[model samples]
Target: MARLVARRGRWFIILPPLLFLFVFFLIPFAFALKISFGEAALRIPPFTDLFGRGADGHLHWQASLANYRYLLTDDVYVVAVLYSLRTAFFATLMCLMVGYPMAYAMARATKSTQNILMMVIILPFWTSFLLRVYALESIIRDNGLLNAVLLQLGLIDHPLRMMHTTFAIYLGIVYSYLPFMVLPLYATLEKLDRTLLEAASDLGGRPWRAFFDVTLPLSMPGVIAGSMLVFIPAIGEYVIPALLGGPDNLMIGRVLWDEFFGNHDWPVASAVAIAFLVLLAGPIAIHQYYQVRQVEY
Candidate 1:
């Protein structure tokens, strides 16, 4: 009875979290899945209506795949998907380029310097995220400091368009997600075996060669991890696009938002969401594979 009581006590602790996940997470997901296939009206109850069966009197819970087909055929959605993919790709690349060197420098710093550098990276995050984005707008606007400097230097005759464009979007993405890349890359690179590089150098490998031949390969796990971290949520990002993207640079997140909130088409919105998930499956699968490889090693 005591043993059973202990097991029951453990279950009591475990069940709450599991139940919480099921109720808050899984149930909503299942509901969304239902919404994806349901017959829907724009801004109406029957917000999503369940399908009915034919004369045989059988229940047909199967959702029509027409929503998926519609998304594929829609030119706007297609273009948005492409834009989202392109933005995310460039953002990830820029983050890696900027983050790798910074992370390496921080990792190689003296203990106190490392702490200071880490704090510097974290300092931006201490502010409200929306406010920081607003600050970026101030910095990158046509009359912003960058344009003022360029104009003063005679680089341009007029203040350049900077606030609302694809470039601004890229700038925002890099600024927002750079720390995510740096922190993980720093963690991995810091733990790297320095003696191995030293040994490689002693064995006649030059510094550049040693880095390419030794350090880079070893840091692959961190690169993959950080890239995945930045890339995944980035594809679904709405805030940065809304803030920085021009009218022409329609990204998937914006499209999803338009469907859900603007057009009030919950079924189509859910379908768009499903399509986004499908598009993301490739990168996610690759990330998962790399994670498995990391685990194996």
Candidate 2:
């Protein structure tokens, strides 16, 4: 009786998140899946029902695979998907490169200094995300802070055309997602065993050599965690690319938006979303596999 009560109590703790996921994520996914097979219609909601009563007064169920087929036929979608992937990959790499050193430094700092550094890393979250993006736009735009500084310093004769470019998109992503990369890395590095390093040094390993052989290897979990944190959202990012990137920057997110709103093609848009979800599952699955292996080890 006690064990049963304890198990039920544990389930009560797990129930909220499970219900939230079911309502928000799974239910929406199911609806999108249903809509993906639907035919586009001129009527409101703009898609035919998967199942409906026919004029003959009989129940009829139907589905169209046209949207899925259309995705395969469309070069624009293929390019957008590839572009989003490439952009996210490079952004995540940049975050890792920049964040790793910062995380390492934070880990090695004195406890009082660590507190200050942590507060600095986390301070960005206090502002609205949209506001921060716009702030970045102001910094990088033509006649903005960067160009004004350069001009005043006599470093350039012209205002740099920094906005509406691929570089700006990359910069925006790195700036926004840098904290995500840093926090995870700092968490892992702060908990790292200092004795391992001391032993490595005692065995005649140089500081750089010990870091490469010991610190870097052990921090792989945090590296993977931080990469996934940045990569997943960055790939699907619509706002950064739309605001900071050129018209040529047709990322998958923008493609989906254009399909749904600009073209009013919900079926094709849903198909694109479903396909993107499946594609993203690859990375998530790999992450899960490694996570399980890490736990087992």
Candidate 3:
């Protein structure tokens, strides 16, 4: 009786979040799936019904794989998917490159300095995210602060075309997502045992060699965690590309937005979203597989 009560109590604890996910995520996903299988319509809901009443009052069901078929056959969507993946991968690499150093510095700092550094890193979150992106836009624009300062310093006779380019998009992504990368790395590095480095040094290993031999391997979890944090959201980023990038930047997020709002093709938009979700699942599944293998080993 006591065991039964305990199990029931555990289930009660789990029930709220389960219900929340069902209500928010699962239900919306089901709707999207339904829409993905639907055809574009001229009417109110903007998609043809999957099920309808026939003239004879019998129930009729209709579903098409046309949208998925179109995705496979269309080159534009394929290109967009590739572009999004490429952009996200590069952005994640940039974030890692920049954040790893910052996190290492923070981890090496004294306790009070570490707290101050962490606060500085997190201070951006207090302001509006949109406002920050807009601020970046202002700084990177042709006649903006960056060019103005460069011109004032006599570094260049003409303003560089820094804005509305892939470089700007990358910069925005790295800036926005740098904190995600830093925090995870900091968490991992802070708990790292300093004695390992000392032991490596005792064996006559240089600082760089010791880092590669001891520190890097131990911090793999943080590297993976931070990469995922930056990569996943960067893959679906719409705003930065839209605002900071040019017409040449045909990312999947922008394509999805244009399909839904620009073309008013909800069915196609849903199909794009579904396909993107499938693409995202590959990385997550690989991560899970590796995690399970590590646990077993």
Candidate 4:
């Protein structure tokens, strides 16, 4: 009876989130998939019928795979996918480089200092994210504060063109996503046993050597977690790239947006989104399979 009750309790905990995903994620994905197989139309809902009544009064399905085919053959969309992946990769790398040091410093600090540092790290969340991005935009604009200060200091004769560039996009991503990287790293580093580092030192390992041999290997979980958090969202990012990137910056998110809203091509947009999900899911699934295998070994 106790075992049965525990099994029921486990299902009770799992049921809510499963229901939520079904309603919110799976249902929407079904609609998107249905739409992707539709033809573009000038009328309401913007896509042609998926099914119709035939002359014999029998239901007939009218689905097309042309949208997916177009996505595959189009150089524009292919370039957007590649560029989005490249930008997300670099952004994740930057976040890891910056966040790891900050996390390590916080982990090594005294309790009081750690609390203060954590507050500083989280303070950005108090304000609106859009507002923060806008503030960054203001600072980097041609006639903005950064250029004004540099011009005043005689560092340049003209205001530097910083906004609407790849640099701006990278800056926005790193700034916005830094907290995601740091928190996981801090969680892992904080729980790490200090005795291991001490033992390494006792065995004649230098500080850097101890860190490389002891600390890094132990923190692999956090590193992977943080990288995934940053990379996944960065790939689908639309606002930062929209606000900060140039016309040449063709991220997949931007391409999706332009297809849906700019061109009002819902079928193409749905196809892009479905293809993007498949592209992301493949790597993540492979990574998880390898991680499980490593743990078992």
Winning candidate number (lDDT): 2
List, residue by residue over 1-297, the lDDT tens digit for candidate 1: 999999889988999999999999878867777788876664456464576675799876556777777888889999998888889999999999999999999889998999899999988868777787778998889888898899999999989998779999989989998988999899999999999999999999999999999999999888988999899978889888888788887889999998877877787888888778878998899889987887898
Clashes of each: 0, 0, 0, 0
The runs of at least 3 residues in candidate 1 whose Cα sits more than 4 Å from the true structure, single-residue gaps closed, are: 1-5, 42-46, 51-62, 285-297
Ranked by TM-score, the better of candidates 1 and 3 is: 3
Ranking 2 against 3 by lDDT, winner: 2
Model 4 per-residue lDDT tens digits across residues 7-45: 889988999999999999889998999999998999998
The lowest-lDDT stretch of 10 consecutive residues in candidate 2 is 285-294
TM-score of each: 0.90, 0.93, 0.93, 0.90
User: Which pairs clash inside model 1?
Assistant: none
lDDT of 1 at 252: 91
Instruction: Estimate, for each residue in 1-297, the C-alpha lDDT of model 2 and write its tens digit.
Output: 999999899978899999999999889999999999998899998999998999999999999898999999989999999999999999999999999999999999999999999999999967777889999999999979999999999999999898988889899999999999999999999999999999999999999999999999999889998999899899999999988899998899999999988999999999999999999998888778877897998
All candidates: CA RMSD in angstroms?
A: 2.8, 2.1, 2.5, 3.0
Evaluate model 3: give its TM-score. Answer: 0.93
- Model 2 Cα RMSD, Å? 2.1
State each model's CA lDDT, in order.
0.87, 0.93, 0.92, 0.91
> Candidate 3 clashing pairs?
none
Writing each residue's lDDT as its tens digit, candidate 3 over 1-297 gives 999999889988999999999999889988999999999999998999999998999899999999999998999899999999999999999999999999999999999999999999989867777788999999989999999999999999999998888999999999998999999899899999999999999999999999998999999888998898889889999999999999989899999999988999999999999889988997777667756886999
lDDT: which is higher, 1 or 2?
A: 2
lDDT of 2 at 131: 84
Worst 10 residues of 3 by lDDT: 282-291
Q: Is candidate 3 or candidate 4 better by lDDT?
A: 3
